[model samples]
Structures are given as C-alpha cells and as structure tokens.
Target: MDNAPNRTLLDLQALEDILQQGAVRTLFQPIYDISKQSILGFEALSRGISGTSLEFPERLFCIASEQGKLSELELLCREKAIARFVEQDLPGKLFINVSPNTLLDPSHPKGETLHLVEKYGLSANRVVIEVTEQDKVDDGFLLLKTIEHYRQLGFSIAIDDLGAGYSGLKQWSELRPDFVKVDRYFIDYCDQSIVKKEFLKSIIELAKVTKTSVIAEGIERLEELTLLEKLGIVHAQGFLLAKPARQPPRALEASQVTQLNLRSQSNHNEMSMSVGCLAQIEDAIGQSTRCKDAHKRFEQNKSLMSLAVINAKQQPVGLLHRDQLTEVFAAPYGHALYAKKSVVELMDKQPLVVDENAKLDVVSQQITEQEFDIRRHIIVTRDLKYLGLAPLRDILKHITEEKIRHAQHANPLTMLPGNVAINEAIEQRLRRQNTFSLAYVDLNHFKQFNDLYGYASGDSVIKLLADVTVQVCDQSSCFVGHIGGDDFMVVFDGDDAERLCHQIINQFELQSKAFFTSEHVEAGGYWATNREGQKQFVPLLTLSIGLVRPDLESCNNSHQVAALATDAKKEAKRYRNSYLFVCNRRKPAAPIVRIKTTVHECSV
Candidate 1:
C-alpha cells in the first residue's frame, strides 16, 4: 500500500541509480553555415529515460545542482554524449555544454573531458567546450583560469545562451570565447522586431571588434535567418534550420541555402551601385613603354580618355591623360624632346588607382576630393593587378539609371514597393525554399467609409494604415507592399507573424477613429447602401489580415502561395470587425485529416 508507481520529483536515490546504471542518452542538433549551405557542427543535448522522474533533462540537471552532484552528473552526460558522438561517426565539431560551476569545481577531474575525447580518437580541436551560464560563477578569476586551462589543451571555448543568462557579456569579455551562442529569446522574431534587431546588431558589432565569432541560436523562421545573413551573421542554429535528432542531417534545405545566396548577390549588386556600370577592367599602358609608344596607343584608341602606367609587377605608378599628353606633344619639338623617354617620366605621378571592387560612390568622392585633376579616368585594379578604367560620366549615368528604376517600381501613395517588388520577394523566398508567413492585409468596410468620406479622406486612411504597418514591422526584414487601393500585402520573413498582425490591427483601430465623423464615432457605424441598393449598417474602418505559410516542398511557386494566402484572407473577411485568420496547413508527411484553422477577433 505504501508503494507508489510514480513520484512528483525524481528521488535522490533514483538519480543515483540512473547515473550508476549509465542510462543517460544524447541527441544532436545541427548548427548551420548559412553561407556555405552545409552542416558546420552539432550540439550534443543530454536526455534521460522516458516514463521516469528524470525524463526531463532540465529537471535532471536541476536536481543534480541542488544535490551538489552537478559536476558528477555533467561529467557523466558529457562522457555518454561524446561516446555516442564518436560511435555515430558524426561529422563537424561537437559542442558539449558544461556549467561554469562544474568547470571550476575543485574536486572536478581536470582534463578528463579532454581524455574522453582522446580516448575516442577524436581530435581535441573538434570538441568545443561550451561554458553554460545557467549557474553564475562568483570568482571570475577562477572561471577564466579554468577556461584558459582547457584552451591550452587545444579545446575551443564557447558561451551558450548569451543573453539568457546573467554576466554573459562579462564572461565573453573575460574569457573571450571562440564563439558566442546568441540566446533564442532575441532570435525568435528578430527579423520583425527592431528591439531584437538592434540588440543582435550590437552583439554582432561587439563580436567583430573582439574577433570572436557569433552563432545565432533558436532561428525558427526563414525570415529570421535571412535577416541574420544580411547582417553577416552566417553561423546559426535553430529548429527552422534543423532540429535536434539522433544523427546529423546530410545537408540543409537546398532552396533555403540558395535563397540566402541570392540575397547576398542582391547586396553585392547594391554595393556595385557605388562603382556604377563601369567595366571592372580597363586598358592601361606599361611603364616601360616609351612616351611615343604610349602616344601611339592612345592615338589608336581615339575613345580612350586616359591610360594607366603600370610597372613590371603590374602595379599602377601614374596616369597619362589624353588631353595633357596631347598638349605636351603639341608644343614645338615636344614629341622630339620626350619621344625616347619612358611613359613614367611624362605620366602624372599622383595617379588615382582604386580597387576594382571599390564602390562608385567612394571612387566618385575620391575624385571630387582630390587636390589634383583626377577626373579624367579612374584606373581600377584587382589585388594590385590592372583590371579596367571608368570615366566619371559613365559612373554618373549608371547611378542615375539605378535610382530611376527604383523610383519607377515604388508605390506612388505610400512609396513602398509595389506589385513587382512584392512578386520578386515571393519568388526569391520560393527559390530558397524558406518558410515565411505571407499576410494579406485588406481594410474591412472600406467601400462604405470611402464612399462616405470621399477619396481624399480614404487616401489619408490608407496612408495612415501604411504608416502603422511599417511602424510595427521590422523594416530590416519585413516587406510591406501597397498592392493597390485598400488591399496591402505584407510578407513576414520572420517568426513574429501573429504578433505583428495583431499590433497592426490594434494600432489601426485606435487611429481610425480620428478619421471618422463625431456621429459615426458615437454610433460606431455608418449607413450605406448594399450592392442591391438596400440600406445597411456598416462597421467603421478596420483591417482583416489573412496569413499563410508555404514551405519549399509544400509550395512550388509564388503563385501558389499568393492563392493560398488570398483564400485565408477571404476566410478572415467572413468575420465582422477586425479579424486575423491563419492557414495552418500541415506538410504532406502528416496524415491527412480535416483541415483546422485559427481565427483571432479584435472587437476594438
């Protein structure tokens, strides 16, 4: 009668028995190299037997900490995890979590983890001892020394869950870990949250200055990972990228990798805007060539504005302008006086030779800021080797064209991207096979409000709605489009789709009252004729957001996503007042069942 099958908490005796019996297990979660499109490493997560009080890893660790068996339990988990990591013949670095308290334990076996790794015949370099900050360490000096000792033994150090724990930055400053794992809380919807974006930005900047690498953890959305890539945080780990499993994946989603690369290419194209449309490599004159020979070559190419003088090593030493050289040869006996001399003697010594990859804006600035007349032609080079030349006029023309193209595609009312850009964004996401939420936001009861208030007032309402959406969305990651009229589209490339739409609904409702008449505001409705010409009461201006998500395998193209999202939007319109309807379609692998949906109604 006293014997009970289950207990609320795992008994201390049971914990000891589990450890003695070697019942601990390990699962591996992959860390992705977004740029490389490959598995960079795997983080080893410890697990306990199911149907037991120690089934939960967190509970197991907590009980161990309370019982002063933290070091013993951690070491056991590490041993079991690493043994399996070797047994599975897993590829990539093995990231093992170790509490700082356990790291500084006086009785803790020093270099035991290292020995375990060596015992498995795995290189110490492949093992990254992640110093977890869950338990705060009081003595910084001891912790630093302990981390350093591991470093000297050839183990790379990492700080886990950077922003989640106390003194994460302090440890980062003191220990200067080889890598810092950003906390999941900040990464959840980082693409749609400015606060998160700015916070991660500062961390990335800090990493750059300190020469430490950053690993964005808990990236569960394509948009979040996309933003991380744009910010140059290439190393990442999350459920969206890959989930924890018994074995590492052969590779990540090829489409997602392609999408990240496409974005990088787009950024490269933007940077090239500084260089204009000028050729990457232009013709140049060798310094060893005689002045007369250089003159003959310039004469051969009548369109040449200037020629770059390069030495034996292909390094640019000077510039020879057609106008100045022509002026020189025009003088009486000038050709005879300088015919035999090397081009270096006649060429302008202070030449402006820029790297081929230099931005056009930077090159233009250099040209305008120079004391000498460097406006003739800019000599471009790659790794000091002559590449090409660009005239000032060509750069200016390209810049103007780029600006004109952007302006042409922008929406006239809100100045946001119109249909073309939105299509391109959708296609780009589809190509990468990244999961992103597409929300179709259309105003509710807009025809009645527009008909009553006139087009001018309606335009004002549309602009206000645009302002609210832009204000709530993370401008860095979210794409807002003015599709046309009262129908707007927002593609959330991050995980904060639900929260973002609700915020938009909340803001629009609170602000729409200002545009209503006193009587309409008091009554909360306006009398309007239906399509049949019968009089009916219509609600005030409110927004209906229909959200849909299409992953790579589920959706073949942007059109499919648009169609599904439109369907979701129609579903949302069925409800009165402000409403949000999300399409929660499951993947094909899941057993097909009755379709389920979630509707959120906002009465305000």
Candidate 2:
C-alpha cells in the first residue's frame, strides 16, 4: 500500500481528486517588463490537488483534457478562481480560461458557471472569458452568439494565444473582441525581432481600427516592456512586474496611486484610449464614405479560410476563426470557398463586438486588462453592427514599428540618426543633387582602448566622437550621422569638408585623454596589438574627409559621387595623419594633396 505523501505531477486522476475534493487552487504569477522594470499584471494559473503549483499551466490543463475531465476541470478551476478573487475582492478583471467547444455547449449555459460567478459576488464585467485560437470551432455562428449573449450581460471576451494558432488577423477582423491578448510567443522575443515587432505592431493597429485594446503577455524583461509601452500597448501582464500572489492588487487611493512607482499615466495613456473615442469611431466606421473599397476589402480577406463576414449592409466583414471552414470549406483555392460562401452560412453566430460610442479609454483599458473567451476581432460600429474588422496582429505591428522608427531615427547611446536614416539623408541630398562632400569620421583604435579600459570607456569614446561631429557640423554647412559603432559620416562641400574633419580631430584628440590611462596616453598613441595582431596604436581619433564635386564631368547621379567619396576617404587614410581627399574621378590621379591634407583621386 503506497501511503506516500503523494508527490506526482498533476495528472488527471490527481486533478480529478483535487477538483472533487475542492482541493484545487488558483495562483497568480506576476508579469514584468524588461525595459521599464515595471509590474504589468498577474496571470492566474491553476494548481493541483497536491497542494503545490504546477510546473506549467498548459501542461496542467493538457493532462486533464487527456483524462476526459477537461470540461469538469475547467469549470472547477473557474469556480475556484472566482471564489478566490471574490474573497480578495480585487479591482482588476479576473481572467478565466474556457474552451470554445465547452462554452458553446447549449448545456453550458445551464451549467453552474454563471451561478458560480453570481455566488462569488463577482460582476460579469470583472470576469473576462479567455478563448484560445489553437483549436477550431465546429459551429462558428453558434460560438459567436453564445459569447455575445454573455457580453450583453456585462461579461467581456478576449482572444487568447493570438500568434499560437490560426488566430491572427482573420479572427481579429471577425470576432471584434473587446480585448486582444497578444500570444506569449510573440511577446517573448519582441524585444529582439523586428519582424515580430512588426507583427505585434499590426495587432495594435487592428485594435485601434476595430475599437479594441491590446494586452501583451509574457513580458519578463524591462527592455521588452519599454518597447511595448513605447509601441502604445495599453496593458502588460508578465513575471517581471510582479509575481503572482494569492491576493489580487487592491485599488489604490489617489495618493497611493500617485505615490506608487507603477506605470506612468502618460505612458499608459499613450497606450490606451477613452470610451469617448470609441463612441466617436462609430461615425468613422459607418461614414466610411469610401464605400467603393471592395478591392481593399478583398485584399484584407485574401487570407480567409472559411466563411467571410461583411458589414450589416452585406460587405465582407472579414473571416471567422476559420478552424473548420479552413479545413472543410468547399473551394478550388481552399480559401476561395469563403469568398464564395454566403455570409450567413459561414458567419459566426454572434461575432465578437463593441459599440463605437463606448469610452475609448475605458474600452482600451478593459481590452488590455480584461480576460475574454474567443477574443477574435473587434467590430467597430455605432449601433451594435460592425463597420469593419480589426486584426490584432496588424495593430501591434503598426505601433511597434512606429517605436522602432523613432528609436532608429533617434539614437539610443548618443541619441542620433543611425545608418539607415543616414543613408536616407544621403539619398535625400542626392535627390536634390546637392554638391555635398561625404566625410568619414572613425575612431582609430577604439576597440583596443575600450578593451584595455571598459565598455563604459568605449561608450565615452563614442560620445566624445559624437560631440566632436555635432560641434563641427552644426557650426558649418555639413550634416553629420553616426554610421554605427565608431564610424560617422558627414555630408558637406568645398573647404568645409576638410575644415570639419580637422576640427573634429582637434577636438577629439583633446577629449580622448580623459578616458585613457596616463601611461597609454603618455605613449603618444603607439601601436598595441589588436585581434588583427598588428602594431595599431590608438590612431589619434581623426576624420578622413572625402570630397566629391559633381558637375557633369564626374557624373550626374549623387549615388555615383557618394561611392567616389568612399574611395577618396580610403586614399586619405594612407597619409597616416588627418587628411582630406577630393575625387575628380573623371580625371585619373587627380589632385592628391593640399596644405590642409593629402587627397587621393579615385575613379568612378
């Protein structure tokens, strides 16, 4: 007889025992942002009968599902979660996970779910139904209608695991969910991937379009949080902000709220919106006087797999969560059947929806903060009918890209235009076909110096170089840009190019002393071994000015001239001292030196 103090993984039998014994529990995990180092929200997780938390939420539920106790376990978890929240009487909405198949069960309505909420003294507004996009629904319309009925009673819905399943743009456009929770996988590395950032940005954009708010989950790092906030994401829920506790957060008093080192209102305001805004969007959606946007409509739904939805006036709404339709739709193109299918047959029974006249800010907050079941798309309409669909991923992408653009244009270290923008600026100069010289400013031995000192010292070197470039360019006819790392580019013409380069070297040579050790500086910048293993002394921070004068002789295209300037800079470096090189590429071996510096003429 194994009378062991049971220490097994939360299996179905154990979960069943826990559920039957009412020993199952709910624990909250804190979500944090890596960038701002702030607390966003807590994710509610299910615990097993063993009186300990499960290793993973998905695994815990998956095992229960395998045992055929999924429905029972979900219901029990809901009840337990509600009771706990009710006991704590927390202010924020309580997120509850529900299976679409189970929630849509006709018998589901008659079940103890609603009774449990009511019994626990919880408001439907305080409860958000979580719907997964990982699975397909048998009856799309029935699913929608069921959730809609609940919405009317004040409970909200949220689309969950957006990037995990077939839940992206299509479901977003059709469901019009009040809230869109970006999948954790999307949020995990968002601080790194631009494509992911673009995808998430699109989700935010769709949210704005469909009158929904976005909640980014799985934020564990501050940089990621900072990026999300900058992208205008309304709410964040992850581990870094705060670890989940048995008790939910209590509403702070005005003073306490102000005093707390939580997310700034301006930051949150940047992310969220007001109900008034949502209400006004009604006119924007219906009055889309651009009624002939059929082409655009088709383009948006080109990816639909099932029945497509349109507005009340019979225009295509978007596609429903195309689980079955994507699988069973009768079509030659597979998704083409949706384009041909009757809106009524393929449409969700009750599409996720929101009124445009609602408070935009409140709605947005509700969206990012609330939990929802089957959070698909958010319908934007004045009178409860949808005007258009909002794809969650697109919305997130737009906002995030906007942030990325801002960050790229504005430097992170010295806060300057990066290489991309520098290239653009050069293109703009070329577009105007201006006679400008491109100056190449580089630190000679930055790596060797920084390696000997520290990264902070390296950063100091960059700042010193940046300051020198700024001072020289701003005071003259040139524009300067950091080409990245130790390289900087300046565009100018005539004697100004050589003049600016000299000014930079003169100034940087002075500033370089502070970051160096007395001995290294006293050696008068002698060559030390680098990874290249050559005697390369910290080349006195200098600029090799490349001047390209365009008259028709050299070439008409500034692109050609810019390339010539690059070659000229290479030539100038051969002199070993700060020098300027002018490219009269049309003339072979043109002027090599002037009093200021040596010039090496290169060809087109």
Candidate 3:
C-alpha cells in the first residue's frame, strides 16, 4: 500500500512527459446529415500514447487538470487536432472541444488558435469552437465575452453535452449557439420510453423556434439512430454511423445510401398529388408585344381570360387581364393614346407563380392569400420555365373532389385510410416495382375483451392501439391504414421493418396495461365465456403481426399481397403471447399445406 504514492508520482511524470513531447493523437468521428445522406463534419477527439497510464483521454485530462495544466493541455490538443485535420485533407467543418473555465482563465493566451489555423493554412470559418459543459463558470459574462471574441474571428460556436451539466438551457439561450448537441442519456433507448421521446420532441421544437441546429451524439444502436431520424434530427454523431479513426470514410456505405434513397423516394411518392394535373395549356404573349396586339388576341379568343407574359427565357414575368385592357380601350381616345406601348406597362407584374410540382393545397393557400383579381389566374412553371396556366376555378374543383374521395375511404373510428385507400397504396408501390414489406396487424382475443368490457371501453382500446402505432411510425416513411374493426396494415419502405415491428409490439403492451383491472392483470387473464358459451380463461389483450416481403415480379397487385399477409397472420396467432411471423414465400400461390416461417415472440 505504501507503493501507491510512488505509482501516482510516476503517473504524473508520465503525463508531463506526454505533454512536453507533444504525443497527442487525434481521431475524427463523422457527423452525418440524414436528409442528404452525406457527411456534415467531424468532431476531433484527442488521446495519449498507447499502452501507457495516460493512454486514455479521461485519465490524461484528469491528471492534467490536477496538475494545473488543463489550459496548456487543451491548447496543445487543439493545435495537434487542427494540424492533423489539415494534413489529412478532411472535409466539412472541424469541431474542437474547449472548456469554459479555460477560456475565462487570465493566463490563457488569446488568438493562439487563430494563429495556429492560419499557420496551417486552414480557414477559421471551418473550425467550430465546441464549449464543453464539464466545469462550472464563476463568471458567465466573461465567458460570453470570450465566446463573442471567438465569433468575431469567424469561428462558429457549439454547446456540448446539453442537459447533462450546469447552465444547460441558460447557456443555450444566452449563447444562441450555431449548434447544440443533446447528451447521450436522452438518446439511449429513446424508442422504448415515451418520456424520452417527448423530451426529444420538445428539444427539437425548441431548436426550431430558436433557429438552432441540433446534433444527437453518442448513438450506438440502429434503433436509436432510426428513432432520431423519425424525430426530424438531421445531424448525428455516433458509433453506428462511423467510429473515430485517423482516416475515416468520406461517404456512407453503398447499401446504407441505397436504403436512405429508397426511403426518400417513398416519402416523395406519398406527398400530395402535384398541381401539374390541373395545368391548362394556353398561348402566352412575349413581354415586348404591343398592348394592341394582346387586345386583338383577347378579342379573337373570347374564352381567354388572361395572357401570361414571358421573357426571352420562356419564364413568366407578368399577367395581362382582358378586362383591364378593355377598360383601357374604352377610355376617350385611349386606343390611339396607348395602343403602341409595350404590354409590360399594363401587366400585373406580381401575379401568383408556382411550380408545377407544388401541392394543390399549398397552391390553394397561396391563391387565397392573394388579392381578389390577382387570384383569378395562376402561372404554373417547370424549373422556372412557364408551362401553362391554372385557373382558380379548376383548383377549387380538384380540391373538392379530393375531399369527397378522402371522406368516402376513411375509417370512421380511427380516421385512418380504409380498404380502397389501402389497395391504392399497395398498387402504387407495385406499379413502381419497389420491394417493400407489408404487415397485417390484428388484436388477439379482442372479442373476449369486448364482451367483458363495454363497447365504449373496447373502442378506447382500438383507438389506443392506433395512436401508439401512429406515434411510433410517424415520419418513418411508413404508411399506416386501418382495414376494419380491429385489423390494420402497415407498409414499410426501409430495411428496419423488424425492429419497428418490435417497437410497436412493445409500446402496445405497455400502453394497453391500463385497460385491465389490477386483479385481472395479476391473474394474467380473466374468466370469460367463449363463443360456444363455455367458461374459459382468456388472456389479456395482445397483438399478432404477420409480415411478408412481396416480390415485385410475382406479386402483380395489392390483392396478392393482402392474401399473403393474411396467411402469415394466421401463423402469428398460433403463439400465445405477442408475436411476429415473417413469411418466407414471396410469390402468391395456393396456400401451402405445410408452412415455412420464422416467429419472434415479444414478452409483455
């Protein structure tokens, strides 16, 4: 035990030697942009010599802090990280960690970081000063001033480990940083905990309001990454995407990129149908044409209400109303006075112009926001080049038709899409020849529960299940539909279908426990009468999910997909607990006498 003092002395000496010799090694971990499927930047992490007492970062930094050399060590790490980053020709921004206490220290040198970056030929604009929340700040005003100093030098600022240390929301609000990274604790198992999910949602919403970009750090599992993506988090840093290394990949793996692209395409397909279908092909006059010429064309074609004025590039510049021209021509000697002038003088230059791919509802909103006369005609374009015109009357008609159709095919209880809409979703996927998974979800022993509880309670349970499914699947590029009564369907466009299925089952089990009485829950079930009027022990409510990956070549329609999913669901019901049965058969054929499947049982 007496040798412990000697060991400590030796460790301190080793740390000193490391600092003097400049033996810090820098490894970069990538921060990914999910929406673009590209690398946004990298966070530089520092380490010491391998196989030594000071090899780990935590020990090295702790010893440095004890030795009153924290600022020196941090400066050395920053220099080395910047040098290595430039030497390796890394891409995007470089995030270097700096403590607040060090910045507030009187002895700490200012402008050193800027000098090193300039010496290494790197731009200050590419470096982000990540203020770590490891130590308390005695003076918040000085720290803010120091941060402002760094900002004036063209350095971006970021707050690290938010919600895990002092001055969390306070620091965030005061700094108004360009980036804020949520701590790892909130990100772990976010999919399983509703509280954590709500916390993240609130953080995201706050970031949106503050106009601050959020980055989720310490992501280690695919489930965590998937949930973060669903919550609208675009920037991420973690082991699942890529580990810290001296040399890292410039782009994601091909398979991962393909999956992201597929999800994006699926989302695009599900967007409201474009307003291009309502476009009416009509003749447009050039901006340089005479007003008299436009008036003559309007007179010849009595149906023409307006003429779109285009420039040399075929882009819409304005709109000329027929009534305006007639009023001008009706004035005393107006035709002789203004007939020779250019049409640009009489055109409405601020007419409503929208892209052909814009949503009908969005275009309607834009039209309604305009003046009464200006809202009469909308100029539609493809890539800024005028294609045709969309009249207000046509837009209103199309929207009315869509509302009627949607009302007819929507489920009354859950307000989810019904059979006709489900079939249409499946057929759309089939037509695109895209490979996707279909899951037919059914409640187990629901009739028995309905018999014991009143219909109101039963309806509550069904709605609860629907709510859980929607909440879990929201923004996941997956479609949810209610077939009827207690049966529902989900279409998955990504590869994480099985994991998502488990989430749904787990969430349903936890939320459904409220419907049962305490005595019934402890007993594991309740005494109920079966359909044959015989007394039996019916288990609590559970879910049965039948999943099938449909083959684009063999499965030609939604009917075939539905049939295969139904068969798979039968196999899932055989298990007593909540379960998932994945069908191996891709083709739609006669029901097999012997089934081939894989089953996963989920414990409540």
User: Using TM-score as the measure, which candidate wins?
Assistant: 3
- Please, what are the lDDT tens digits per residue for candidate 3 over residues 24-84? 9899999987765667789999989888878888888888888889999999999999999
Better candidate number, 2 or 3, judged by lDDT? 3
Which regions in candidate 3 have their CA more than 4 angstroms from the true location? Answer: 1-272, 331-338, 368-375, 591-604
Whole-model alpha-carbon lDDT for candidate 2: 0.59
What C-alpha lDDT does candidate 1 achieve relative to the native structure? 0.78
Alpha-carbon lDDT, every model: 0.78, 0.59, 0.84
Q: Which order, best to worst by lDDT?
A: 3, 1, 2
Candidate 3's TM-score reads 0.54
The 10-residue segment of model 2 with minimum total lDDT is 280-289
Structural RMSD, model 1: 18.9
Error of 3 at 91 (Å): 24
Model 1: residues >4 Å from true position, as ranges? 1-10, 255-604
